[model samples]
Every structure is written in C-alpha cells, then in structure tokens.
Target: MNELNPLDRIRELCEQRKWSYYQLSKASGIPYSTLNTMLNKENMPSLPTLQKLCQGFGISIVEFFEPDRNLQGLTKDQALCLSLFTSLSQEEQQLALAYLKGLSRTL
Candidate 1:
C-alpha cells in the first residue's frame, strides 16, 4: 500500500475520530492554528509535533510511524523484537538466526 504523508495520516485520523482541528489541537495541546495549517496545507509535523500527537492519542511512536495499520494490533514485545531484528548487521543477523535454530533443536 502507498504510504500517506504524516499530515495526511493525521487528517484521516481526525476525520475517522470525528474531530475538528480545534478539538485535536486541544486534545494534543498543540496550537490550534498550527494544526489547522498542517491539516489544511498538508504539511508534515516535526518529530516533536508527531510525538505530541501520538501521546495525545494515547499511542506510541511506532503507531504513528505505521501509516497502513494501527500499531496497537501488535504486542509490545513483538514490536521491540521486530525493531531489533531490522537493525542487525548482516553478520549479526546470521549469528542470531543460527542461535535461534540451535535453540529450536534443543527444544
């Protein structure tokens, strides 16, 4: 699926939640005019702004980064594992895979 820009995602969230820009701003403690400008002009939020939005919506940074689906659907441990896996060097990846296979054999 194509990814929506951050502002587009925020706009969609607001519409789905039946929230006005002012309501979102109030909820997020972001300035109403800034939120309005972002939504109206399709401007991307800064990292701090995105963080505030996620916090206001009772969500995590991973959730905000996932444009296609809700992050709440994934367990915290699963997300953490995935993050760690994706960051591994190629050699480290091979080592981890081998370790897992060895553990599986023992079990």
Candidate 2:
C-alpha cells in the first residue's frame, strides 16, 4: 500500500461521508472556491485549512494525520464490507444482511 498523506486522508474522509466538495466547504466553513483551487492545484492546505477539514470530518488534527489503519478498529475486510454496504439502499442492506444470516445458519 502507498503511504497516505493528509490530502489523501481528507479525500477518503469526505468520500466515506458521501460528501461533495461543496458540502465539505459548507461544513468546514471554508470557501468553496479556495477548497476547489487548492485541491485542483494539488497544493497542501495551510494549517488552518487542514484544521477546518479535520473539523468537518469530526476528527482532531492528530486523528486526521494518524497513519495507522489499525486505529479505526476495523479489519480490511470489514472496512471493505462496510463501504460496500453503505453504497446500498436501506432496504437492500436489510435484505442483504438477512440473506447472510440465512446462509450462516446453513454453515
């Protein structure tokens, strides 16, 4: 796996939240234009901007910068399962879980 930087981390955070850049800008109280420009330019955020992104993600700067995957308390498989589950509709999720439960009983 590649080393994740603050930018990559913040993007993943936003994606996990199903947020648009505009949504993140509103949440972070940062200007949408600035956020767009910075990200498009591949420029790292200033400390203040980084802090705002962290705030938007409901994480402290330390947690945002923490490179350890284990801190999330999920195995890679679990994380993949969760992300896939999140992409499903509420009814689809319920049905999928029910099917899994049924299959488990036959094991």
The regions of model 2 sitting more than 4 angstroms off are 1-3, 67-107
Backbone clash count, each prediction separately = 0, 0
Q: How much lDDT does each candidate structure score? A: 0.72, 0.76
**Model 1 stretches astray by more than 4 angstroms:** 67-107
Clashing pairs in 2: none
lDDT of 2 by residue, 1-107 (tens): 56657677777877766778888898789999999888888898999999888776656777676634433888888878866664454456789899999999999
- Model 2 deviation from native, Cα RMSD in Å: 6.4
Q: Every model's Cα RMSD, please?
A: 12.4, 6.4
- Best candidate, TM-score-wise? 2
TM-score of 2: 0.61
**Model 1 Cα displacement at 78 (Å)?**
18
Best by lDDT: 2
Worst 10 residues of 2 by lDDT: 62-71
